[model samples]
Target chain A: MAKEVRLWEGNHLVAEAAILAGCRFFAGYPITPSSEIAEYMAVRLPQVGGTFIQMEDEIASMGAIIGASLAGVKSMTATSGPGFSLKQENLGYACMAEIPVVVVDVMRGGPSTGLPTHPSQMDVMQARWGTHGDHWIIALAPAFIHEIFWATVRAFNLSEKLRIPVILLLDEILAHMHEGFRLPDSSEIEIVDRAKPTVPPDRYFPYDESQGDVPPLAAFFSGYRFNITGLNHDKSGFPTTNPEIIQRDMERQRRKIERHLDEILWWDEHELEGAELAVIAYGSIGRSAHAAVDRARALGIRAGLFRPITLWPFPEKRVAALAEQVRTILVPEMNMGQLVLEVERVAAGRCDVVPLGKVGGIPIDPPEILEAIKARV
Target chain B: MAFDYEKYLRMERMPHMWCPGCGIGIVVKAMLRAIEKMGWSQDDVAVVSGIGCTSRTPGYLDFNTLHTTHGRALAFATGLKLARPDKHVIVISGDGDAAAIGGNHFLHACRRNIDITLIVVNNYIYGMTGGQASPTTPFGMRASTAPYGAVDPAMDICQVAIAAGATYVARGTVAQGLLLERYILNGLKHKGFSVIEAMSDCPVQYGRRNRMSSAVEMIQWIRDHGVPVTRAKELPPEELEGKFVTGELHVAERPEYTEEYRRLIEKAQKAAEGAHG
Candidate 1:
């Protein structure tokens, strides 16, 4: 079969990639910058014998996805800003319960509904610590239309592979941008299915830590009966308040993602081999920084770019290694210095970390990034 | 011969999360009886619940169950019903969970009229959270949050369901266990949205706050105070004023949400195929 390269909007690519990745269920309330995802799924899912429900609100949207996932389907929900806030509790539940589902947050300006139809990456920190409790999440920020398609596939793969809710953090620009992308054939895409218990139904335990951190999920009506509760539960899914069990359970939940950091972590590094000035960025801002890097190189300033694909694990080891070789790191984002703090903490005083912050519903200008790199040089 | 209730009960799991002498236990037993009489396989049933004392009913049942977040059981059950319409889907929730925090979802689920049975265990208070006044707490009834006496008018959940378009709506109390069981079985059998409000007692919080200290006292209050719909209809307009008429209050035939959705999809598919051919 001939490879088909097509011009697609970022949202359409994401929707198409999700369908190819076997996402049979999507429950999301439409929101700006992200509504196209819900719209595409509304039209496309039913054609493939899938389910798409527009929930009453984002909270119910998140809840429905969790339930659909338990029934042996790859489910997801998309939203931006305030809708993301409404989903925190159930996101915590998905984290604690180890339910595999994808959450797509197309970033917008906010503390609360600040800018509905504009671009801002203010949710960087919130995505990591928005939900209560100790949970390590896999968050990927795609810079271009092509990356949105692949990042969505990666999000589903990471969610199912680790049994954690993976987030695809797309900004308004990248989400709504139209660009050309090479659509991979179904055979070319690698899909990950949820782990299923090999143990007999009588011996199956829903939260069996000894059986490995990621237990196989049995679909409802699969003749494998198990309890799934938000409360601290034993191996058989029955609630237990024992301190020792609770301690071990919390550790297992954290370790499931932390232990597999190598597979979960991803990044894009450009020209950082022997560069003194490094620009750290992600999402749409990362694309802007890439252009700024090219402009700086044309001016004969040795500047490089480091974009984190996995935001939660923070890519600390990679950042720490890169920090040693760079004299100064310029962190430019659409938010008021959120990721700069992480870069500073990880850089550990080895390099000077500077943040070029913006939060008034505007993307960071490429010229500003160019100026920051010029100054560092 | 009467069914062996003890065999159905998971002895090791008890004493349950319910408070001592709580009517929730009785209501749960009634539900189990209804399930047994219907002869539905435990494996084929999926009980989804939200946070509250009533939501704990699924924890005791020997079936594939889910204990979900607060006030979201209906949403979760909707997904389950859509995914596998062949399975029996029952949502167990509290007055607060169903009518307060989850009020919008409750109304919309009724409006959708999907094939699912919802048992709103109305103990008249948020029992699990220490007797906070719920949407169904009686007017002028004392609660932890409403120490000065609840001045606001309480919600009538059955009326809300009936108005919201539930196909079958009924009200029963712990005092009417056999009748409550019958209502639950009927609700389960109904092919659309079926709501059974199981009036229960919260002796620890609600009972103490409202001065009905004992579970037996609460049962007596329900028995003496509840006016049957048939009897209320016979009373004069003046005599029947200001009283709650409890029974199978409403039953109607309506197209279920999922069935209608399927029909629309089929029609669209056939149209597309016809157009192409």
Candidate 2:
């Protein structure tokens, strides 16, 4: 088949990719920079025999997607900062219940509703820790319009494979940008569906860990009259207060991601061989970091760009290795140094960690990053 | 032969967490009886609930049960129903869970007229949190938060459901168990959004704070104040003060949300096929 090349807008590609990823249900409330995903899904989902619901609020959107997911459908919801805040409790429910659902938070400037129309990486930390409780999350930050499509696909795949909520972190620029990319043939794309129980309904346990860290999730109405709850539960999926059961399940939930970090972590590094200064960036800022690295190398600065596509689980091992190889790691982001803290924490005084933090709704331009790189040199 | 309650109850999950004389168990029994009367298999039903004593009903039910976050059971059930329209979906919520923090979802669920039956157990107070004044706490009722007296007017959940466009609306109390069961059965049969507000007793939290301290006293109070809709209509407005009318309060026909969406999908697919052909 001839490669199907096409030009695509950012948010529209998210909707298309989600469809390609077999997402049959979407429930979302409108929020700036992310509303286009919902709008596109509204028109597109029905055509593909999928369901799209414009829920009453962000909380409902999150809850709806989780519900759909529990009923054996791949589901997603999109939101920005304020909406993301409203979704925390339900997001925590998804995490606790071990339901597979994807949440896309198009980054916007905000502590509250700081800047709706502009972009920021303020939600970098929030995506991982926004939901209450002790749980690990897989968040992907796609740098370009094409990557947004693939990232959304991967988000669903990971969410299903791991039985956890995956966050697709897109900034305002990446969310609204236009770019061209070649679409893979249907056979070329990889799609993952959640594992189903091999045992009969009576023998099925929703959280049975004897199978593996990621238990088989029996869909509701699939002859599995099982219980799913937000409360701490045992393998039978009923709420339990037994200290040992609670601890084991909590540990298992954390290990579900931590044990598979290598499979879950994804990133692209440029020109890092024997580089002295490493520049770390993600999302829209990654575009600038790539350009800045090229500019720095042309000037004999030996600066490399390490863009983390999978932001959480934070690529700690690789970042620590980079710290050992490089003299300095310069972290640039749209927010006032969110992921940089992770870099610093992992770097752990092994190398000088410099943060080129930028807020106020402006993209960190290549020249600014280049200037920082030159100064580091 | 006695009703086989054990057939529907998760034997291991009992005895339930509700306080003694709490009417949540009665409401749950009524719901189970309704479910059984509908002739739906336990596997074909999905019982979802938010955070509350009433919301805990799903935990003890032998069905596809989901104990969701606070105030979001209806929203969650909305998605579940849309995904599996074949499955009978029901949301069990409490007064605070349905009318306070979750009020927006409740109103919107009614407005959407989705094929969902929401059984709002109106205990008048937040029993889970120990007698906090909820949106439905009666005026002048004593609660822990409103120690002096509840100054705010109580919300009539049935009226809210009716006004918000629910296709079927009914009010019943735990005192009239069979009536509540009948209303629930009717709600399950309704094609669109159905709200059955079961006025239940939170004897430990709500009744104790008010004058009715014992379970019998609370049940007597409920039995006394609940007037059948037919009799209440005959009584004058002043004579019906402080009395709630039981039985079906509202019924309107509209396109159910899931069915409408299915038609929409067919239309969209046809258009897409036409474009492709």
Candidate 3:
């Protein structure tokens, strides 16, 4: 087959990639800047022998995906700000239970439904620490339509690999914008699936620690009948109050994603060879940051771009390395210093971390980031 | 021979987390007995529950059980049933969890008519949270939060399930153990949405605030008010006033959600292949 360049919207590409990545179940409630993903899946999933449920609400949507994923299907749900808030409880449940599923939050302005149709990267911290309790999640964001497709595919792979919920965070710009990109064939994509139990049905434990940090997931209806609960549990999947077991499981949940950060995290750097200053951003802001870096280099100032696709793990080590090479690091986001705080925490005393945050539903243009770059240089 | 509950129960998680003389254990045993009677494999069944005194029942069961968030058991079960139609999914939830916080899910699950059995343990008071007035708390009944007496009218759960289009709706009191087991078994056998509203007792949280203070007193109260649907037909309207009717309330025939979705997939795939051809 010849390579086909298709004009695709970011949300549409997400649904397309999800289908290719073996996501057979999607339960979602529509929210602005992300509804197309669900709408597309509604028509597409059934044709592909998948299930799509428009749940009663965001909470139900999140709950449904967790349920479907447990039944040995790759499932997902998409939402925006307010809906995202409603999903936090079950999102935490997925974390504690280690159910592999994908969640997409197309970012819109909010503390509560602030901007429904406009762009904002405000969910950076919400994606990291949205749900209550101590847990780890892999959150990936994309700057354009092309990466949105690849990011969603990677999100499923990482979610399945680590047996955790991975968040694909996109803002209004990347979520709604139409762009041209070469459609990748599913056969060429490296897709990862959840491992099934190697033990017999009698010995199969849902949270088997002996298997590895990320235990093999036993299909719910499979003869390996095991329990799954939000409460801290032993390897048997029965809720436990034992102190050592609790600590061990909590640490296991954290290490499953944290220790495998090399396998879980992804970022791209541009023109950082002896650059005196760097621009750090993600999602749509990274798009502008990349353009700004090029403009800075054209003006004889060394400016590098460090855009993180994996947002939750925060790419701290790479950020610190960039901080050392650059005298000042410019961190621009839609939210007021959410990721910049992490950047500062990691790069503490290594360099100056300047934040360029814009609220009230507007994208930070390249010139503003370039000005930050020029001033720092 | 004595039935081996240990065959189906996760005995290690015991002593099970339920109050003394709580009705949840009876309901759990009835469900297990029903499953045992049906001879379904533990692997072929998935019991899901919400957060409540009743929702904790699944943790003690040997099936592929899930203890989910409050009031969302049905929604979760809906997804599970849809994805794996081969498994018989069942939801066990409390009154407050099912009708109050999870009320929307309860009604919609009925409307969708998916193949799942929902056994709602309607204990008038919120027993897990120290006797807050629940949606099923009869008017004028006292609870910890309803010290002045509950003002909200108690919801007729079976009526709502029937109105929402559940294919099978039945009523059973936890006090009527064998009868409740029969209703649960019949519910599991139903093809579409099946709901068994098992009126439960929360002696400590509810009974103490009202007239019935002890387990015996509460069980006696449940039995006294419980009217068999067959017997209620013979009683006068005034005599039957406020008396909850037990046994099967409604049964209907409808296409289940999962089967309908499968048909949709087959049709969709045919159309897609035709279009490609």
What are the lDDT scores of the predictions, listed in order? 0.87, 0.92, 0.90
DockQ of 3: 0.87
Candidate 2 off by > 4 Å: A1-3
User: 1 or 2: which has the higher TM-score?
Assistant: 2
Ranking by lDDT: 2, 3, 1
Cα lDDT of model 1 by residue, B64-177, tens digit:
899999999988888777777778888989999999999988998999899989998898898877889999888889899999888879999999999999999998999989
Pick out the ten consecutive residues of candidate 2 chain A with the lowest summed lDDT: A1-10
- TM-scores of the candidates are 0.97, 0.99, 0.97
Share of true Cα-Cα contacts across chains kept by each model: 0.55, 0.94, 0.86
Q: How much is B107 displaced in model 1, in angstroms? A: 0.7
Q: Return the candidate ranking by DockQ, descending.
A: 2, 3, 1
Candidate 1 has an lDDT of: 0.87
Q: At residue B103, give the lDDT of candidate 3.
A: 94
Return whichever of 1 and 3 wins on DockQ.
3
Ten-residue region with minimum lDDT total, candidate 1 chain B: B3-12
Error of 2 at A213 (Å): 0.6
Top lDDT prediction, candidate number: 2
